[model samples]
Target: MHAIVLYTSKYGSTKDYAGWIAEEIGCEVRETKKTCIEDLAPYDTIILGGGLYAEVIAGASLLVKNAAALKGKKVAIFSTGITPLSYREYYDTLVLEKNFKDGIPEGFKVFNFMGKMILDELSLPHRTAIKALKKLMSGKKNPTEMEKLLIELCDADGDFTDKDAIKPLLDYIRN
Candidate 1:
């Protein structure tokens, strides 16, 4: 099957995953910024990757916006975020709700992967945003469970990208 990987990344995590997926599938990979949905029509399968920022999947709206053109193609989406993988509710419900408002396409599959967050690598704006978010969440005298998790995630650092962690996604796409 002809396949292509398209992605948008910040801090390079999403791009890294997109590259690995393309390599594993032996297909081409392109950044969404340089490619349009119309350009992808010839491919039977498409894998879209993006980084999760403030619960939003960066650039994923393009896929939804162009869904009419992408209908009937095999679609897969993956998100790279600092959120821990164990938080299925946050990823599956919260994140999905933020990313796919009309719902994912019928044959599409979604995957989430752990991504890196280096405080130093973050731009001043992003760093300030995270700090402000943390402060807001910290002000809650009786923080909810999710608020506590957010506070902890604010301090997350280091790379969590594991090549082995991508096996399941690769297997699904290969099938």
Candidate 2:
């Protein structure tokens, strides 16, 4: 089957996953900025990847806005974030709610994977935002467990990309 993976990355984490998925499926992978929705119509499978920024999936609205044109195509979305995979409730509910407001299209699947954030490599704006977020969470008198976790995650640094993490996606694509 013909497949194409499109992705956007702020810190390279999302692009890393997109490259891995393309290697597994042996299909073409392009940055979302370089590929147009109409250009993807010929592919049978479409895999999109983006990094999570403040719980927002980057460049995802492209797919959501063009949902009608992409109907019936095999669609998969993957997100790279620092949040631990154990936060399924937050990712599955809050994150999903924020991105798929109208509803996730049928036949479309979503995946979440651990990503990296090198404090030193972050752009000034990203660093400032992270610090600001931490400060805000810390100011809460009795922060929720999730808030506490976010504060901790703000300090995390390093890359956590693993080939094993791509197995589930590969299986889904192959099936």
Candidate 3:
């Protein structure tokens, strides 16, 4: 099957995942900025990767907005973020609700991967936002479980990407 992996990464994690997925599947990889819906016409499978920001997947509107055009293709969308996989509620509920307001389309599959969040590598605005979020959550007298997790995530400062994490996605694509 003809396939392509397209991604939009604010940091490098999503792009890295896209490359790894492409390498494993023997498909073409391109940044979303360089690709458009028309470019997707030739591929039977389209995998899109993006970094999560405020629960939104970067550049995902490319697919969400063009869902009708991609009706028959196999579509997989992945997000890279610092949230731990143990937080099933965060990933399975909050993220899905915010990203897919209209509900997930029939042929689309979603995945989430642990991503890097080195404080030193973050852009100024991101760093400031993290600091602000940490401060806000820290000041809460009785923070909710999710807020507590956010506070801890603010201090996360390393690459959490695992090459092996791509296996499930690969299995889905292959079979």
Candidate 4:
């Protein structure tokens, strides 16, 4: 299959996954910022990988915004975040709803993977945002389960990127 993997990564987690995916699939890998929708027209399969920040998938707008341009192609998106996988409902529901406001297009699929969030490596703004988020969540006298998860995730600091996580994405494109 003529496929290309596009990724936008801030801390290399998404880039790592994209690199692994490209290596396994034997396709070209390019950063989303360096590539455009027109550049992707030559490929039969298109894969997008992005880091998740406050439910928004970084650089995914290229795919969502240009959905019409990529019509009839095999499309798949993978999102990376520090949020734990036990919150499947949150990922499948809230995340999906926010990301795919219109709807998941035909011939498209979405995947989620654990991402790294090293406290020391975060930018000044990201570190501030995480602290603010944690404070806000901590203020709730009895936070909901989701809020609790958010609070816990804000404190997460480590590398959770795994090469095996790309298998589902690989199988989708090959099949």
Q: Which candidate wins on lDDT?
A: 3
lDDT of each residue in 1-175, candidate 3, tens digit only: 8999999988899999999999999999999999989989989999999999988999888998899999999999999999998898998899999888899987899999999988998999999999999999999999999999999999999999999999999999999
Once fitted onto the true fold, the runs of candidate 2 whose alpha carbons sit more than 4 angstroms away are none
Q: Give the TM-score of candidate 1.
A: 0.96
The parts of candidate 3 lying over 4 Å away from their true place are none
Tens-digit lDDT track for model 2 on 5-107?
9999988888888988898789999988887788988988999988998788888878877888998888888888988888888899989999999889877
**Candidates' C-alpha lDDT:** 0.89, 0.88, 0.93, 0.92
Give the clash count for model 1.
Answer: 0
Worst 10 residues of 2 by lDDT: 160-169
Off by over 4 Å in 4: none
Positional deviation of residue 165's Cα in model 2 after best superposition, in angstroms: 1.0
lDDT tens readout by residue for model 4, 12-125 = 999999999999999999999999788988998999999998899898889998888888999999999988877889889998988999988887899999999999999999
lDDT of 3 at 130: 95
* Model 3 residue 16 CA deviation in Å: 1.0
Number of clashing residue pairs, candidate 4: 0
